[model samples]
Target: MPHDVVIIGGGHNGLTAAAYLARAGLDVLLLERDDHLGGAAVSADAFEGVDARLSRYSYLVSLLPKRIIDDLGLDVRLVRRRYSSYTPDPVDPERGLLIDREAGAGPDSMGSLVAAFARVGAEGDADAWNDFYADTARLAETLFPTLTEPLPTRAEARALVGDDAVWASFIDEPLGRTIDARFTSDLVRGVVATDGLIGTFTDLDDPALDANRCFLYHVIGGGTGDWDVPIGGMGAVSGELTRAAREAGAELITGAEVLAVDPDGRVRYRLGEGEGEHEVTAGTLLSNVAPAVLDRLLAVGTADADARAASSAIAPRDQPPFSPDGPLDVPPVVRERLRQLAAPEGAQVKVNLLLTRLPRLRDASVAPEAAFAGTFHINELESQLSSAYATAARGGIPSPLPCEIYCHTLSDPSILSPELAASGAHTLTVFGLHVPHRLLERFSNDELRSQLQAAVLASLNSVLAEPIEQVIATDAAGRPCIETKTTLDLEEALRMPGGNIFHGPLSWPWAEDDASLASPAERWGVATRHPRILRCGSGAVRGGAVSGIGGHNAAMAVLEASVVA
Candidate 1:
């Protein structure tokens, strides 16, 4: 019997759609090219001979909705950190800024801001900080819940935000201007601007406001925009989604590469290391792969064949129905648009390390555990960040790499063995920004990897009492247990085009007033021109980060169409 739906990728979004559809009594089949389910959210033993399970690719959780967790009955725990971040001044290493949530403080309390600004000896800084975040807090509360629902019109979203000045700064003008106008300290401005450039490769003043779109998604997730650490590891999130889909009776196949997909729900695939091919059919197809990949598969299975046969002495009327000029469901123009969608280039590098002991900070007053427990910003001044972006834009690596470090073991030690935990073993994950994919293209992969590792260590050591290398743990063979991944590395490992973590630059979540159509499918933002096919991945609107919004929206679209029919 044909399945109700066949999903082409088994990433978190695909699993999410499978779970929901299967729970609704529809037969679902999920195919994955990788042996594992999670795409970039997996936790693995990154270092050789190291027992620690580090979040290798994408780390941290913020965009995931509580409604999805409840609806799917997912067993995942996200822990909020008491401290938010700590940034030390490169000029005066003895003083630093630390933002910590006071004990028993409410989520909306501005105590952390007030405290951190006061510590830095900046006059009127607390008030400025409060004034700046107050607007974002309102925007988060107003706009976040609407993400799970249908996309709102621009007028409707602006009305909900209720402040014309706030809207003008964020929506009309560049985010860099807003950051510079609102904050006095360069370090504080840099901290806020970093949110805009995560996984996005544009400068702060880009006219398109690509950086602003990225910033909005980062700050609006979970209705308050606070990023939380997943307990156990990032794998726990994927593990729960896998269990939910399995329990709901969704069939999942691993190591099965999908060769092509037909608009009529026909799927051709091959098993691992096998020469034989197999076919499956479904009532509808939900693609979790990137749009470019889907376009290539469809062209190979349909248009290329039609062109091949047309060159022969075949009558037009006798041609197969799958021809471009025949009764194809999706038009050739739409297919071309999908194929020509802009490819994303990742601008961040990830480094994972196993430390024998946390390094002592230049500011001796702050405890190492307190500073490293949350995001530790290193050499990321606003001027420095802008300089790095300008340098990378010109195809040059910045002299001093600007990066942020997070110590996962400090928050949850369950990932480490009892012996390692007792021996003060910790894990440090650093994310370096402005190191675009194009820069790595100039050098061999091995050379670039070595250069990035050295740059990260040098940056971190500049603000520390001792070089970070002194505290790095060694394997049995005396090799340092350190691992680094660049944009090129991620592309080869995860099949991410250009190594873009978000799949591509994010677009506005709503249809414009001048849009050609006003239907729910357009408002929902998941439909393709093909009637029986849909997108359920990061390419969809409001899709990015670790959120399963794409999958949830796609499932809703299918169910709504079924009811209407």
Candidate 2:
């Protein structure tokens, strides 16, 4: 007899759905093309017996409904540590302004944020900062539950957004404009607005700017704030989920390869050693591959017309640079200079720093007692970050590379060997989105990548008293891989029509009417016009970081499906 559900591509979402269906007693079988599950969430052997999050994409959870964790008893594996925070004040010499909760950091998290904004010299900054975040916090609260909330009717959405102040924020404002108009200080304005740009490739000044902000709002960590890593490493969550999936009677296979699944409902696989093709079939098929891949799968027999249409119809869109063309663009002046985007794949980069110790603030005295507030950008301000974006548009990597550093060790050390965590060593993850891929055009060979990597490291040294390069352990050959998957022209590679991660420009035309058992939304029950498939995981999602939202959301969606059934 066919299994009740056959899930393909064992990424978190796929596994998550399988786990739910199985727990629901639905005889679910999840198959990953690769041997292991947690596709992007899996760990790798970078050193002898040392495993770390392979791509370590987004290493924190926010906007993930706590209820799901409780319902699935995930709190046992995913613990929310109190040490997640960051600073945006470059000139203050004192970081930790954004949200510091340690002893004497401030009256509270918001208070610390207000104080941090004040240092940047924004007039009316404190109250303004408080009001801003209070509004942001509320939005996170309302939309978070609404995410798992059943499909909303047009009326339901209007009513929810109407009463929920946070939901109301996204309606009319572009993220960048809102920041500049309200805050007097560029540092504060840039700092607050900076988040609106993270993970997105949109030009901040773009017309559809507010969408990223809404995406940002959906990602908040509920007092824990957005963006964090597990205590030891992201592998903890992956390891835990793999364990749970197995305990629940789900089989996980690694190294087994599946080349294709024909529409005839025959699943073909490159089975075990010295084996032949293996096949499996089920009454229902669930796929965890990117919506693109999933489209190909469901399109097999045209199981459902809308799913097939969506799969074939999906277009990959690029995350446009945050800046659009025109005056009042970058900087206060240069109205007529006429800026351009990085020529056809600019030289953007990502530099991962494995630290022997926490990165010290140039003035270390400010955060004397704090372990990790996530990170702070230094040597320059937000303009510097934006400047890289601007420079890359011309097809050249900004000489002094722009960067942001986050201390993962201190943020959440539970997953790591206590020995490593206590040893006071950490890894820093930084990416250069502004660098254009076209700049690679400058070199005939790999020399362009080398030059870019060296430049980023050097710029980083200039900012830090102790540069990360000093302690980088060389391999057996005494040669180092300067950057590890270290450089990617993301705008080119992942950007597709259905909306690329850059700027999340594809999230337009919000679909409220989700399908329910009572009434399905058109042909799609829980799917969307946008690729309902999530690419959000370490490296796979926005460059890299190992947070489990992709998995979490998939699981929640599965639960929602249960609700519908």
Candidate 3:
């Protein structure tokens, strides 16, 4: 008998769907290609013999909803940092702008922030910053709640936003114009623009407004846009999801590589090495893989079906009954739709480093603890960011490469062993922007990794009192505890096409005005052309970052369809 639901790819999102569907009384089966769960969200010891469990790929948390945590009873703690962010002045290494999270809106509450902005020659930007974020906070409060629910129509979402000015600034026009109009300081503008550029390759002024979409996801997390540090790292988040899935009776199979998927809810896979192919059928199938990956699976399934049809060896009894309501074969329209999606190209360089101690900053006004506790921006002035993007688009690595660094241990030291913690060792995660995946074709992975690593350190050293290389901790094997993953590296390891973190370009959380929301899947924004198959990953609407909105919505869609049936 077919299971009620089958989930492909046991990432956090897949686990989320399994847990919810199983708890709702549906028989759920989840398959993962890797030996372990938590794709890109897992914590591991990147440094050989180091007693550190670094959140290897994706680090900080912001987008996950509390509803998911409470519903699943997940034992997770998200710690907000004291400092929101610190960006050193690109021209003056000794000065920086630091935004304190604890700073309120009252008089004298803005004193320290005002001075910091003044120090960076952004005297009036402190108020601008506050005004800008206040708008985002309102937007977050309005739209964040709609994420786990059905896809609201564009008109509905716009009306819910309520403020005409906020909608016009964020949703109607390019984000660049707003940034330019709101803040005068290039440094301040760049700090604001970073949100739009994170993991997204696009011009801020581009009419496509991809940057606007990226910016929306960034500031709307948790309704406050505070990116908190997860206690025990990202592994704890996935670990809790895994536990919930298992406790809810979701049968999870690791080391199961899915070879093909039929739209009629048939999945063929090989389990581990030396294993024969196994086939399973489900009433509903949820895809946690990238859309491109799903298309490949469908193509493979179609080819396999054709070869079987031409053969006389297979008996009719061996075949699963094809649903008359579903397509008899993988439709050409489905392939064309997937092809039309923007070719995902991740334009960031991720570097994980273990430091013996936090490096001192050139800006003496701010303490090292405060500077590194939150996001530390380097050479990311608005002018510099645009220049870098222009250079990168022309197929050359940007000089004075713009990057951001943050210390996980500063907020939560649980990731390190007690001895390392006592010895003042910390973990620094560096995310370098504007280094697109296409660069891999020009240089080998090793060559690019080396070049990028050097460029990253140089960028960091530019604003440091001392070189960061000196503070890099050594592992047991006498190797530096610095590891880097390029977009190409991410694609090879995580099966993300072009190593795009959002799986592909992110979509608006709501449905378009002309969209057909007739089906439960379409209403939830998880629909593909196939009725039984739905996206439950980053490719789904309101999907991106570490948020399980995709998984949550997909499960809700299935249950809704069941109710209708």
Candidate 4:
């Protein structure tokens, strides 16, 4: 007999769906291409012989809802950063702006923000900053709660927001214009703009408004827009999900490469080395892979079916399971929608470094601990960021790379060993923006990685009292514990198309006014043209980052369909 549901890809999202479906008495089977679960969210000791478990690919959490955590009973703890961000002045390395959120609403706290703004020659930006975030906080409160429910119409959501001017600033117009009008300081403007560009390659004023969509997701997390560090690294988050799924009676299989997926709920896959291909059917199919990947699977399955119809001969042993070129056999509307999607391209460099100690800054007023505790910005003046984007768009590496650093150990040292913790060792994660995947056409991964690493270090050193290389810790291999991953590297490792971390471009959480919401899947924003299959990954509406919103919504759709039937 067919299983009730078969989830393709055992990432955190798949695990979430499995846990939920299994608990509801559905026979669920989850397949993971990798040997382990937790696709990008898993933490690993990135450097050999190092005891520190860095968040590896994805970092920080904001969009994950409290309801999912409570329902899963996850033991995850998120640490709210005391310092929001610290940006060193590009013109004067001796000065910087530090947002001390921990200072609270006291006069001293307000004065500290005002004084920091003045230090960077942004005299009146303090109030502007507060007002700007307060607007986002209101937006968050209005939209965050609806993430798990059936999709809301654009009109309904706009009505809920209840502010035409605020809505126009975020939804109708370009975010660049809003940033330009709100903040005076170049450094402050750049800091605010970075959120829209993280993992997305787009100009701030792009008429397409991709940046606006990206910006909306960034600031609407948990209604507070606060990105928190997961205690014990990201692994703990996935580990809990895996445990929950297993305990809930979900059957999970690793080292399973799904070769093809039929719209009729048939799935063909191969297990680990020396294992034969296997077939399974389910009443419902939940795809936890990217939308591009799902399209490929369906296309390959269609081709395989055609071949079987033409001849009865078995395929050659050495032949690849699927070819890259093919057209999907799904309904025309769905095929056209998939084809029209702009080819996804990631535009950032992720570097994980093990440091012996937090480096001191040229701005002596703030301690190294305080500056690095939250986001530490480097060479990211608004003008510099725009210049970097222009140069990168022309397929050249940005001069004086714009990057941000987060020291995870400061927030939660449990990711480190007792010896490393005692030795003042810290983990620094750097996200370098404006380096799009298209650059791979100009240079090899090794060449670009070497150049990007050098640029990042140089940028970091410009604001530091000493060179960052001086404090880098050596791994057990006796080599510098620094790892750089370009967009292509991410594509190869995580199966993320074009290395796009969101799996695809982000979408507005609510549906367009013209969108059809006739079915349970449609209302839940998890529907595919093929009724049997549904998306449960970042490609789903409101899906992205480390949040399990996609998985939660997909499971809800499946459950709702059953009830309707």
Tell me the TM-score of each prediction against the true structure: 0.92, 0.73, 0.95, 0.95
Error of 4 at 194 (Å): 0.7
Q: Whole-model Cα lDDT per candidate?
A: 0.83, 0.48, 0.90, 0.90
Q: Write the per-residue lDDT of candidate 1 for residues 109-178, one digit (tens) a residue.
A: 5665565676666545667766777788888899989888887878888898999998888878899999
Q: Name model 4 segments beyond 4 Å from true.
A: 309-324, 327-342
TM-score, prediction 3: 0.95
How does model 1 fare in lDDT?
0.83
TM-score, candidate 4, is: 0.95
- RMSD values, in order shown: 4.5, 9.0, 4.4, 4.3
Highest lDDT against the true fold, candidate:
3
Give a tens-digit lDDT track for model 2, residues 275-388.
Answer: 776777665455444444433443332333334456799642322223223213466434322222311122335555444565555455455225244445543355665676
Indicate the residue-level lDDT of 414 in model 2: 51
Q: Per-residue CA lDDT of candidate 3, range 386-437, in tens?
A: 9999989988899999999989999999999999999999999999999998
Q: Which regions of candidate 1 are displaced past 4 Å?
A: 103-115, 304-342, 516-520
Clashes of 2: 53
